[model samples]
Target: MMLSPSDRIHAPVVLLVNPAAGRGRAGRVAQAASEALRAADLAVDVHETRERGDEARIAAEASATGARALAVVGGDGAISHAVRGLLDGEAGGGARVPMAIFAAGTGNDFAKSLVVPVHHVARMARHIAAGNTHVVDVGFVDDVPFVNAAGFGFDVEVLEHMRTPGVLRGTAAYVSTALGALFGYRGFRANMANDSAIMSRKLMTVFANGRCFGGAFRIAPDARLDDGALDCVTIRDISPWARVPLFARAMRGTHLTSPHVSFHRDHHFHLRFDTPPMFETDGELQQAATCDVSVSVRAGALTVIA
Candidate 1:
């Protein structure tokens, strides 16, 4: 039920702004989004962050104040930071507030997967005003939350390099880094498994809670956000010559049928690598010296405005 203004203790909605997100466009976008929310007749609170971990602090405070919802104004990185804050803040058992993505980031990959009108804060504000809500799954990779997709291998390395400071943003970064990694990097061997079977010599493995990631790569084409199941895709070690066409096909989601590809759905995964594996989630690279990775899904953990 919708609570009246007097019945609500906090502002009806809160916007957590990461100014550095999207390579510095977040500040402007957050301002526009806040204005739009006000125009919607919604009591909106705008909080700007100058450093990392601010989104969570803002969100935790908003939740403590009983805000009706939070609109995260940035890319998946901002959203992920908020997730950490929300989950940690409510560790004592407070109800987690609903969240919406404003999609004002470089890739905005997670927002893209949700078809949330990339980089359009005003329209998203309207959609939230209209009360469109969908609860979607969130993935926990080695205890860190990933709302969109997580992966290891070629893609993760590219993400690591693309995300380096001083590089370009959006798909340009992804494409350039991917080409660089593809031509010079040697594939690695790893082991993967679910409940049924174990596979090794993995070239690339993706555990998806949403369809596309990496600015536009449809790695897990059949994945669904709210399905409560993790979509798994694995590409066994293939020759460097074959990797190019495969990535091209992935853009159109036509790579799933290739003989080198394996697609399935599962609830959990156990991954092991000889050395610390390069890993990425929601397009942010994690410098985790992780030899073993555990991933599982929290169904309907995220309530999003479509």
Candidate 2:
């Protein structure tokens, strides 16, 4: 259902801005969003994040002050941090606060999954004014929460490559890294189990909470934000040369039909890598680990202004 503008009721909102994100343009974008929300007659408080995980701290403080809503201005990393803070605070007997996003960072993949407009601060602000809240599901991998997707193998390598100095930035960077990794990468062995089945794979695996990643890749086209299940995708071992054509098909979401690719839905799953394998949660690479990782959906766990 589409939300109407009349639904907004001037709730108090705190906007957390990551000044260092998007090549240091997030502060400007945050300012613009704040103005737009205020223009819509909503009370707005803006804060600049100090460092990594600062979004969480600032959001917790705002919720402590009785903020009714919290909006983050940055990429998936910032949003994920803020969501963790909000969720943790609520669990710790703090006030429940609704959240929103003003997409301003590179990729903005999570925001795209929400069907939110990019490069349009006013439209985002209007959504906040509408005040319609929808319950969204979040995915948990071990103790970490990722509102986007989590993956291992090739994707994790690409994420790691992107962190290197002089690596290109934005979606283009992801594309370049993916291409480089496809030819230079070797498959890793993993043991995976979901609610209905267990399997071993020697390639890449992705567990998606949202449909898109790497800007616009519909890696999990059938994924639903409110659905109680996670969309799981696994690409079996294939020659490096074959990966090029498969990747091309993935762009159109037709790769699922390929014999080497497998897709399914599960409410919960556990994964174990044969050796310490690089893993990524919400596009951020985590330390190499030989640990057990589990993913489960917290159904309707988050209230978001949509």
Best by TM-score: 2
* Total clashes for model 2: 0
lDDT of 2 at 5: 27
- Tens-digit lDDT string for candidate 2 (93-176): 666677888877888878867865546788878887776778889987776788888887888788878889988778877887
lDDT of 2 at 3: 21
RMSD (Å) per prediction: 2.9, 4.2
The local distance difference test score of each candidate is 0.78, 0.78
